[model samples]
Target: MYRFLVPLACALSIAASATAAPRLVEPRLHIDKEHIGPARIALTFDACMGRVDMRILDVLLRERIPATIFVTARWLQHNRQAAATLLAHPDLFEIENHGAMHVPAVDYPTSIYGITAAGSPQAVAREVEGGAAAIVAAGAPQPRWFRGATARYTASSITEISRLGYKVAGYSINGDDGSLLGARAAEQRVAAARDGDVVIAHINQPSHAAGAGVAKGILALKKSGVHFVRLADTVAPHPTPVL
Candidate 1:
């Protein structure tokens, strides 16, 4: 199962209403935390598709920043050498499950942007477990966290995924807005991050402008004395129930 190219329709689904509430039937959910501490933050990257952003990888390697990377099976197939390289630095990177095919992690019949939800509880589990299987097959440690295709999920889907024994990793900051926010805006959004934020940006698609912004913002944060930590160092809080 592979997602050839991210469907453009996924844009609207990924950019769901910022003012909506999360419902069991259909929910738009993510986390919002001002600061986890005074000067500590966690940087999580997504290798969802496309080429690995060496620019982002270079900064993390040079600074030795800790990051939790959510990798989809499709990406693993596309970037094996890079994944192996990242795994070689176990101390700096924690590999996690994104999904088998980069499908939205929901059981609803609705289509997000243009990507359809997994559609059934069982399908969701397969999407998740398949991703983990890919990681382990590559000789990496089993993932402890799962971040869905577009970071969106139904309430039940979250519960189901949790029941499977992995916590869903949601970010406090949308650093790249699925990589639509230009490099500068993406950089500012991340650089202005408060303490304890779990910032997510794509490590795939190096050509995208967002990756560039994330690198600069990460570098700026490092210079400002902000300590970058892994998702496991602290905790990836579950999303709150939408109002």
Candidate 2:
């Protein structure tokens, strides 16, 4: 009986340690992604779900603008043609992980800005890994970066995700509020971007009026001489982890 209790105590100890969030060297941001070179801006699209924003993609492709795309498993399952289309333009885009179920990568099972987080550190890791595996199984290269649902993270969750070998992709600009925007608002949000800002917008809502705005903003940025780049070209993700 004593031996059984000892094992139980040890198990509880381990679980307790695992539940505690790690100390991060930095504070996490609502959108923490960085950008490219001096005159360059990184335009990142999040396909959270739904049909491809051909309105936005068309302009990017027509202009030969480079971009980074973050995709979820559900989005891939539902948008095969879109995935194939993106893969066809490898030079124009880098496909990265969004998560298996669009779960927020946070330390516990509470809502943040209406997002349901993964609840535990291990669950967060699974979300990151599952997203990567799904993307790889779909035939794209292994993703070097991940941005969880809502592009928000607790400092510890982001740190743990970084430890799993993917840089937690944060954005310098919220280009579209989850694709909820009017054309003018979307255009203003993105067009107002400064050099070196990693812009985060959506490619999941083609029917959304904001999609057209995203296109307009991209074109406006191009017209203003802002060069586009892939996240890879800017940051060599997977630096030595602080943890």
**Compared with the true structure, what per-residue lDDT tens digits does model 1 show for residues 140-175?**
998998888878888889899999998888777789
Model 1 earns a TM-score of: 0.84
Q: How much lDDT does each candidate structure score?
A: 0.83, 0.83
Residue-pair clashes, model 2:
3
lDDT of 2 by residue, 196-229 (tens): 6778899999889988998999999999987788
Which residue pairs in candidate 1 collide? 9-113, 9-114, 10-113, 10-114, 36-195
Q: For model 2, which pairs clash?
A: 32-170, 33-170, 33-171
Q: Estimate candidate 2's alpha-carbon lDDT, on a 0 to 1 scale.
A: 0.83
- Angstrom error of the Cα, residue 31, model 1: value is 11
